[model samples]
Target: SYGMVIGYCRGDHFPNVLYGYVMLAVIGGLYGCIGGGFLGLGLETTESKQPKWAQLLTEMVAGGMLAWGLLIYQLEWFMTPPRSELWAACLGAAIAMIWYMVRNKFDRALRVAIYSMLGAGFGFSFGNFIQGLGQASGLSYNWWNVMEFILGLSGGIAMAYAVATTKWEKTMQPSRTVQNLSIIFIFLILPLVNYFSGFTEEKIRDLAENLSVSDIDSFVLFQHIEAWLSITLFAAIGIAAWWQRASDRLQKWFSFVMLSSLSLCYTLLALIHKGFFHIELSIKNSITLYLPILFLAVWLGTSITQPWLNSSNSAGNKKIWQLVAGMTICIILIALISIYINNPTDRTPQRF
Candidate 1:
């Protein structure tokens, strides 16, 4: 509905549509607020009445659809110069769909958390970029860019808030007394692949379409190599993380989130500081990339939970299954995230 309305607003045929859509957004905001209050200032579910599989399907579908739709929309958005007017249309549709999903009844805490983490991720990302340019010697953020960053932050917060408070998905949180340190170790090891992927250069993409074909072969090669290296590393990390995630090790759940967050540190401190367009394919980056793998290997050697040894015992089957189910959820979530941005360009340092 909002998409149609946004489209109509910009059409030369309908000047009246703009005012009505703005009014609708205002009204929709109120609707969300009122419904959210009734649902909860905040509430935790005590009953295990909800069906886990159905909720998992809903979450998988919702997360997948949002990622796929946004990728298609944003790709055209970021790449196109002639259709700048339609960007708002994409934004409106995204917000409307999110509102519909969040307003549904489900588990409040889980929704809030999923939304919060996503928000934090984006906020942290934008903040990193903003600071990156601001701190650069020759770069400056005028009033326009500052305003843009503020708007980005606001939009991210709103989206996160919508996701977190809604009872949309109901999956059990891992709170067993066992500490799953391997999960964290694996997450930490994933991003080293990003910084390390500089070894191979393939003709993967053409980022500088404006340049004459022969003018910047060297620059293009550099960018392509960087991209390949980064993405290869990203893939390696995902596989390693999933392997540990599936292991029957006792690790704290939050540790996994923290480990995943190492990508942020790499992006902001190292990637950004190095500046854009300077990334290259090289042997050094490739060799250093194995550091995370080595660290994780050491940690796995001392991990407290022994999955393989216990698997032979029949009564320990439940614990193994719990680990299996937990890994299933994590891998599904990781797969959903991977669908969005596979061939990450130099434009963005990629992370989930």
Candidate 2:
């Protein structure tokens, strides 16, 4: 979902400058497009016997263009000269209007765009409110953290809405028990993980005093452990569900929820690094931060594709499985390449 992508891109909470905005736009757009393309390829079967490469390429390009155009518009409006909350509100309303007009025809595209814009507007407002509260309470203010929190929360809400509204085919419907279990997992278990993993001042102080570790070291260790545990739990659930032949609805729900929650957690961790402590993003600081989420994404992709491989009801099903398998491999390879590019080997902390 576009909301998920926007939330992930806000993890660093880029500086309020033209260059920073540009980077945010590019990252958000690319992430959304790549993710959307993969999902489309994995879930939808094509009637035309066109080459897989051509079909995938077309889908990717279309997704990229749509996300990039909308994100550019969003960033430019948010970052241009004389930024105002009023302007942000107006911009969000305008996008909502467009969404309404296009909802009947371009339902998917409009949903992503409208949700993203709405989330941005709400995040900005909530950030300002938090900043004010901090000032009034004589506490240290971290506007970036507030912004990240709002974006993550809003994005999660939007993605949840999308999942609820989707019209799944008869073959894809999950049993009531599975659906109820998903709701409990998402609404209950997820919030508990996030709450306990949150690096609040008290938690950090306890970690430091109890473990005799430096602040930065404790922060890094906590983040790494949390990411690994959370992602592993999600991947395990997804794999088990697929192996048990859970319905398509369950798989889809888990995928969207994992994506949304991962994005939220990623940004929350980043906010702890950059906002609370003023640490900069560097190889040593951020390399491991995103790795677990990427792994989870790839693992989920494999799980989704594996089912198609098992279903041999027709020649069409066989072809679909092959195409999806290729896509899954490609996604994993790209994630691995990214890990290499980010260079996770550096041990020195970028900041204390």
Candidate 3:
């Protein structure tokens, strides 16, 4: 959303690339807020005590604010002027997570957070290097998408590995409310936010044309269905889940519903844009567009197969030092790659 907005405002790729640093920081903040909040919630659930909603909210807000603040400070100081400043946001988020973890004494979760942060940091830079190689190869594929996939894949694997390998205390299952709300945010709210942000008037018109849509009124109706209709379906599912709040598999059911609904939304949008009977080779190439859905399906399958692992109180000073060393190594590696990919024509670093 901000990318499109900045692109339109700046009217050039170079300036947009510069401003994109700020946007990346903002995105980092969002990720930190979501990630930290979810982790805190999970940790709290492990105890027999009820959910501490206010404390969780505070931690989330603090994580987001700190991440954004640190990145902005670095940008203002022109720190690493020629290189990407996204690492600052990652560091800020890690610090915030550790601070709250220390407050709660969630040693095991803290280690997981540190490991995940390091994985994401390294994954992003390494993904960028791979993207650069792809671009240099003159391949017609979407290298940017490949980078995103790598970043997510590596970060996810790191988190999962951390959870599985570490011994954990038995945690109370998260309540239906927590599970439902998390699913809503992940599947409904997040996508809607992204959709609305990029759904400008010009974009709508272009989409209509691209879909081979001829009638403007028809397109308007299509938009309404795409937006409100899906919301209605989601709301119905939400209400049903609430009514059956006692179900043990509410999270799994909600996950399946959310993914299915989102997939339906995308399929309907495409079908409405282009007639059902019509087909094109461009449609074949657009398979890359739905790769996220595939990824999400795999993640969902994994979660269902292996529920949240039991956590332990085993993160010691030695592990902390190791994680710190790992993060430092990631920084140096990213720096070397950034220098290697540096191009005069490309003002933006060729990295995630």
Candidate 4:
């Protein structure tokens, strides 16, 4: 999604930085909404009390509003120019999630958020530097996609490691209906929203033209079919949830199916964006398409094999200090590297 935004925001492309940033925030909010709301749904208080659906809604609203209204809009912190500023939104969402955890005393899960933020932040910065190196080498690869995959993989690993090392209470597990619904949101609904939202009508037309699709009308009809299929899938999931029979089976294979679906969706999306459908493969296109899949595979594999929340999880003062220091060094190094490797491109905006 950030890659698409970058393409659209380039001066030679759409030249709509404002639109880019707004969409970035919206993307962040959407992420926060799903992530935070699901986390809220998954955890329970010590007394076996669970958060109400309204409270989960509050997580979505708070995360979205804070991500949009705070640093992105009001404070105007353009910390990483030419890159998506959704980090601000992630932080905002983390704050909301942490607050809820503290309120509910789901303290064990707090490390998941903390470590995830740390890991993602480091991954993004490091990935940016790596991307710069790739570009400098003039390699025909999608470094941006590599960066995004690194970010996701690092965040997932950090969260999982945190969970694995921590001894968690056997809190109440949500019902099958709730679990199924949550899976649908994460694996299907939100991704579909992203697909439809990112591939706007204008974008589709541009992509179609570039791809030499003579029948633009038919191409658009194809997109409409995709959208309709999404709606049908969503409705089907809802019906399955209502019935409660199929949802269980659905959950068992949901990850694998979603992994394949998303990988194919993005690959097709990339082919259109790249304006070609051919047998010959570019290393860039391959990485851009498959790196996320690889990362997801790693995550899925580790999840199935790894023991979670079985060991002691402690964040002592020394560890906290070490984290802060390590993060500080990484930030400084990334800043220096970015400056040395390349000047900001058209996407970099002057905030002050």
* CA lDDT scores, all candidates in order: 0.38, 0.41, 0.54, 0.57
Please report how far candidate 2 places residue 243 from its true position, in Å.
Answer: 1.3
Candidate 4 lands at a TM-score of 0.63
lDDT of 4 by residue, 54-152 (tens): 874578468857875788779876655556677666556556766776676655555555655566556655555576678777788777777676666
> For all the candidates, what are their Cα RMSDs to the real structure?
17.1, 18.2, 7.1, 7.4
**What are the per-residue Cα lDDT tens digits for candidate 3 across 138-225?**
7677777676766676666666656665666677876778977876775568656755665556766777677676685667666756
Distance from true location, Cα of 28 in model 2, Å: 9.7
The candidate that wins on TM-score is: 4
Cα lDDT tens digits for candidate 2, 1-352: 2232222222221222213223233333333333332332223323431125464355445554554455455554333322222323333334333433343233343344333433343443344334334444565545444545554555444433333344422233447789668755754466457556665556656645654556756565765566455555654554454454456666556555545555554545554433323334554333334545456645654454322222221123354356436534543343333223232224311111
In angstroms, how far off is 221's CA in candidate 1?
1.3
Better of 1 and 4 by TM-score: 4
In model 4, the runs with Cα more than 4 Å from the true position are 1-41, 44-47, 52-93, 175-201, 221-280, 286-288, 295-304, 307-310, 313-317, 343-352
Give the runs in model 3 whose Cα sits over 4 Å from its true position.
1-37, 46-76, 80-94, 165-200, 209-216, 227-231, 234-296, 299-312, 316-352
Ten consecutive residues with minimal summed lDDT in candidate 3? 2-11
**Arranged by TM-score, best first:** 4, 3, 2, 1
Question: After superposing candidate 2, which stretches have Cα over 4 Å from the reference?
Answer: 1-104, 141-143, 166-234, 246-352
How well is each residue in 123-226 modelled by candidate 1, as lDDT tens digits? 32233333333433344334233423443443345444444323342444544432344444443444445434532223222433333335456665565455
| Count of backbone collisions in candidate 1 | 13
